[model samples]
Target: MNGDWLAEGRAELAAERILDAVRMLFVEKGASAVGMAEVAETAGCSRATLYRYFDNRQALYVAFAGREARQLIERVWLNRSINSEAGRADQLLDAIASVLAEVRKTPHLAVWFEPANSGIVAQLSNSSDVIDAIGAGFVAGYRPALTDSAARLLGQWMIRVVVSLLTLPGGGEDEERAMLRNFVMPFLLDDTTTIE
Candidate 1:
């Protein structure tokens, strides 16, 4: 039993090290452009070992993205000061703005949003269940009355909005905030309305 626990610990450590190494590569070369051989070399692991941890580049990307997305969500919530007295729309705008600022400042994350890489980012964002859960969690904070399916749908929409802004930002931060406030907040504020 002790040996099994030790082996598991070691495996987790090796996987984390590989992920750390790949993060730097993602920063330098952009996420979509990175290849498996490059990840193995950067991670100081044999291709066999890298493959053992991640079946393919897509799996590796999903793992890395899931980890980063969870961390980003935690940071955004931790740093934000939510005023209960503020209107829901105002509060939602603040949350969106905070998330955007966090992604923009994080190097590995920002690289995912670069024009050349945004397509891959969008695909992953749309497909990843981890991301969907994160979005649902965000929506739940604001609309606790929503059913799980409704929250998940709204969460996905919110994520799509964020990705759209990241892929093609507005004229500036003020403009982006204005767009969110004007366009996104209304739909969000009405929890009774069905999406699609």
Candidate 2:
């Protein structure tokens, strides 16, 4: 049992090291341009070894994206600045804005948001269950009244909004906020919901 545990720990460490290499590549090159051979070379592992850890480049990207998404979600969860006491509409808006801010703050993740690469990232996000679940969690955080399916649908919409902004940002932060308020908030929030 101890040997098995040790083996698992070692495997996890190796995977993390590989992911770290991939992240550095993402920072150096655009996310859409990174390849598996480059990652394996950067990671100082043979192709077979890299393949053992990640079946293909897409799989590797998914793994890396999942890690980054979870980190972003955790950071948002721990953020003290997010006004939990605000109305549900405000809270949802804040949460979505926070996600954009966090992604922008990390250059490695921000590379994926660039216009040239945003389409690839958006496609990957659409297929990523991890991102969907995180979005659902974000929605459910502020609006517990929503059913799981409703929250997920709202979450998916929120993801689309984020991707749209990342691909084509507004005039400025204020403009972005206005876009969210006028365009997004009304559609997501009910008429009875008050925005404070």
Candidate 3:
């Protein structure tokens, strides 16, 4: 049992190292352009070793994105201040702003949002179970009465809004906030709204 635990720990560390190396390459070159052999060389590991951790480039990208998403969510929640008396809309607006700021400021994350790479980022994010769960958790927090399916749908919509903004920013923060408040909040917060 002890040896098994140790081996598991080592495996996780190796995977993390590979991910770290990949982040740099992503920043230097868009994510779609990166390949497994380059990742192996950058990580200082053989291609076989790299494949042992991640079966293919897609697997590695998913792992990296999932890890980053979790960390980003944690950081956004930790640093954001929510006024207990504020309306749900206000709280959600704050959360969105925090997330946008966090991702924009983080170099590794910002790269993924660049126009050249945004399509890949969107595809991965929309398909990722991890991201969907995180987004659903946000929906549940604001509207606890929603069914799981409804919340999940709304959560995905919220993610799409964020991605759209990141891919092509609005006039400024004020404009962005207004767009969310005027356009998104109505459809998003309306209990009677049905998503198909």
Q: Which candidate ranks first by TM-score, i.e. highest?
A: 1
Error of 2 at 129 (Å): 0.9
TM-score of model number 1? 0.90
**Candidate number that wins on lDDT, 1 or 2:** 1
Error of 2 at 96 (Å): 2.4
lDDT of 1 by residue, 138-176 (tens): 887777888899899999988999999998998999999
Model 3 misplaced regions, further than 4 Å = 1-8, 78-85, 194-196
What 10-residue stretch in candidate 3 is worst by lDDT? 1-10
Query: Where is model 2 more than 4 Å wrong at Cα?
Result: 1-8, 78-87, 191-196
lDDT of 2 by residue, 145-181 (tens): 7888888887888888888897788787888988998
Candidate 2 at 64: error in angstroms? 1.1
lDDT of 1 at 132: 95
CA error at residue 27 for candidate 1, angstroms: 1.4
Clashing pairs for predicted structure model 2, backbone only: none
Rank by TM-score, highest first: 1, 3, 2
Backbone clashes for every candidate come to: 0, 0, 0
Give the clash total for candidate 3. Answer: 0
Q: Which 10 residues in a row give candidate 2 its minimum summed lDDT?
A: 1-10
Q: How much lDDT does candidate 2 score?
A: 0.79
